[model samples]
Each structure stands twice: as structure tokens, then as C-alpha cells.
Target: MDLRVLEYFLMAAEEGSITHASELLHVSQPTVSRQLIELEKELGKTLFTRTHKNVSLTQEGLLFRETAREILALYQKAMRENTGAETLAGDIYLGMGETGSVVFLMEQIAVFRERHPGVHFHLISENADRICEDIEKGLLDVGFIMRKANPLTFEILEMGLRETWGLLVPEGHPLENATSVTGKQLRREKLILPENSFFQSELLRYLGAGAQERVGATYNLIYNAFPLAKASRELIVCLGYPGERQGGLIFIPFANGKDAYASLIWKKRPVQNPALAAFLEHIGHTVSE
Candidate 1:
């Protein structure tokens, strides 16, 4: 298949009309339509469905669209790398969990910006499993995850920080005065927890038996639970309690000694973007020092 024809297909897919794609590509409508037909024959897939008014992708077309976009992005990236641009410039997609060690990662990013101002960072905060999912799908280049990741899939770098688990409750609650809490105490109240399936299982195991039934709600972002927690008596159990109390909530550490550590990970790629490679090298040198 021709690269130019792939662009024509992508344009038509985006614009939803062969005439619109022809206008954008500065080609005749018949030319664009002919190329699309040839592309379908070459791939043996009906990439689009047409109506009198417009066009849309089929299920196979949707899947192919995603793959084609990634291919174009990578091809452009390779060309940029070979062109020998003096300054490093590209987007770094990173996913992470909420951990105190993120401050350390930010510090590295801060210093890295001084040398290569052209580099940009995109950060997504999520649990270990979701982070790993995005990395495996090639959507993310790196992730800062809490707890151990699958060694078979990632090149892991231990971040050397541990996060203590704790409960967040309204101020003046009975548990507020306690230095630490126990599994039995955690079971006594309606609990708000993280929505990650793997982490939920870990929490259940840590809390021992009978704690799962007390779960009141689960949240993707911990902050979203705070409003509900303030409005009611529900208590949230989470890691790395915030230093400054907010919304009249108090954080008390768990007494049972369960804690989680942070790790930086990426898919074991044979080749990586120069910008990403530079950032990883910077992290290594900074950590060693």
C-alpha cells in the first residue's frame, strides 16, 4: 500500500466525505475515491461504509484507524530523529499512581527542562494495572506505579520510597485522636476505596475477613470521594495521606504495618524516542547521584 493513499484514507475517514478529503488533499474527488478502493482491495477489509450523505467507519475500520494513526506517528518520529534536529522535542506520555515519590519524579522533570526546553510532558494519574494496560497498548511511554509491576512486561526502576496506608475521616471523629487504626476498626465504618480491581483485592486481604461488606463506595480519583466523605460518615482508606488536611478530614495511619512502594516502569522496547531516551538517562544519572 502507498503511504500517500494511507493519508488519503485517513483524511476521508476524518472528514467523512470523499469530496472533503479531495479538497483537503488538493486532489480530484475521483482520484481520492479510486485510491480508497485500491486500499480496501490491498488490505482485504471494508474500511468504511458509505451513505448518500456521508461515510463512517466499520468495526474493522475503527481498529485499523487506531493502528494507522500509531504507524503514522512512529514514521514521523523516525524521520524527525534522522533529520538531526539540534534540540530534543517530542511528547512524553506518562501514567502514574498517587505516591509521595511523585515529588521526586517532578524534581527530575524540572531539572530536565532546563537542558531541553523543547520537551513536553503529559501525565496521567492512575493505578498500577491501568498504567500497565496503557503502556502495553503503546499509549504511554512510561509510568510511575505503586507496588511491584509484572517483571515480564516492564523494565522496572525502584523509586526508593514507601507509602503508608491510612484512613481519612471527618474531623472530631472518634478515630481522629488515635495514632493508628486496626483491621477491626476499619471494618466498623462504611469505607470509601480505590476502584482498581487488583488494589481492591489487596485491601481486602490486608483488612482480613468481613471488611469487604463494609465498602460504601469506590472512586477513580481519591479527591472525588472527599465530598461524599464530608457529607456523610463514610471513611476513605488510601495510601500516602495528604499532609495538609482538607474539607475537615483527618488522616490516621494504619497500625498493622502494611505499606506500598513506588516504581518507575516502561515497556521493554528495543528502540525509544530520543527525547524519551534523554529523560530516562537523566533519571538514571540523577538517581545514582
Candidate 2:
């Protein structure tokens, strides 16, 4: 339960050896072992599987590792924001889905950093749903999402950028040479699509009845699905950006398809963090100009 013990546990997990962890921590080997043992007892779970030479996480340890990281990150963020009271210095955690609008956001960040050099930015790339969840949990200060934000829970800033939806076709595939594809045409092909339920519903509505039957797989991120798409010769239904060129793959737009608009969102709450406040102000000014 102690943060120090959590640190010791993480160190041992990373190094896979108690001696190595102790060496890194500048603590005695037995001290590190004791702390880990105490941690396991406190949690009432065996965290690590021991071997003669190395250690590895048990199934429970694997899950708890994620929780431990989040706890530490939140603690670190709080400490940074509270300590630097005299200076405009703190961390701004931002989550974003993969989109070309990120280019615009990065440009704004560059400008913001130039004005407040002491402030730091942490960028996390994830799907829109995950990003929104983190913002709601106070883990992320802001997020760039490809879907509309619920006005009841979030303040939204439209980026004025729209991404076209399309299919990623492998070379020599039947649809590779097509200029544009239709939903009716897509229904005939085995498709890989985005994993978000809201997005899936929209696509399914466009594809009409029985379209769900043709879905081969769903992916949280598009890049991870590219290999499977190529090997299986399945079309990937994804957002298309300008100047996008993938070797051995072709991006063909959906004829008359609805575009995905980008939006920057944050939880509707009083601005407490100075860095986040400045960032929101800068974004508002940038958008207005």
C-alpha cells in the first residue's frame, strides 16, 4: 500500500531480479525483497512468480501494474503542479486519437510552450472513447476526439477539420483500382472496421442491412490492423487524411460518405490547473483568430 513499496515492486518487475532492483534503488537486496513481500501480503495476492535467476509477474501482477502506474502518474502530476507555485510551470496531460488535426494541435502546443517554457506536455495516443474516459477521470486535461462530445459532460471546440472515411485495399486486390467505393459495394467485401460502437453504428447504418455479417475484424487503432488487413486481403474501413500514402496499400474514398469531424474536448469543470487554463485560453484565441 505504501508508495515506496510500489516503487520497489515496479523496480523488481522491470529488472526481473531482486539484486538488480536493489542495485538500482541503492537499497539493500533484502530490503527490496522484504518490501515486495510486504506488498504482496498487504494486497493478499501473489504478485510475482520467482525463479532461480529471474522473476515475472503473475496474472494479478500484470493487472495491478497498470493500476500502480496510473497512481504514480497522478501523484507525480499533483506534486509538479503544487510545488511550482511562483512559476507558470506544471504538466498538461493531453490525449488524442490518431488524426491529421494533431498537426494543428502540436503547432498550438509549440507556441504555448514558447510562452511558458517551464510548462510540460504529456501526449497520450488512444481511441476517442479511451481519451474521453481519461479526461473524465481527471487523468487527462484535454483530448482531441473524432466524435462529437456530449455537451452535458464536456466543453467542445470544433477544429474545423474533417476526415473522409475510406477503405484501405491491398495491392492487386479487386477494389484497389477503384476511384471511390459505395456502402453497397463494401457489403460484398470482407471488412475490418474501427472498434468504437458509436462509429460502428454509423457505418452499419450507411451500409444498410446484413453489412455487419461481412465484418471480418475490428481494431482499436488503424495502424495495428494494417498487417492483418494486407494478409487477409480484407478492406479496412478507416478515416483518410490528405497526402496519405501507404506502400502496398491503396486508400479509396467512400462515395458520398459522411466525414468525421475533429473536436477538442475537456470535462465541464472549474479550471483549477494554471497550465490547463492557459492551454484552453490559447486554443480559444487560436480558434477565434
Per-model RMSD to reference: 4.2, 5.8
Residue 274, model 1: lDDT of 66
Worst 10 residues of 1 by lDDT: 240-249
Score each candidate by Cα lDDT.
0.81, 0.82
What does candidate 1's lDDT look like per residue over 45-118, in tens digits? 99899998678888777767656655665676778779965677766888987656788899889999899998
List where candidate 2 sits over 4 angstroms from the true fold.
1-86
Candidate 2: tens digits of C-alpha lDDT, residues 114-195: 9899889999988888888877765677899889979999999988878988878898888777888888887678889888
Q: Which stretches of candidate 1 lie over 4 Å from their true place?
A: 1-84, 241-244
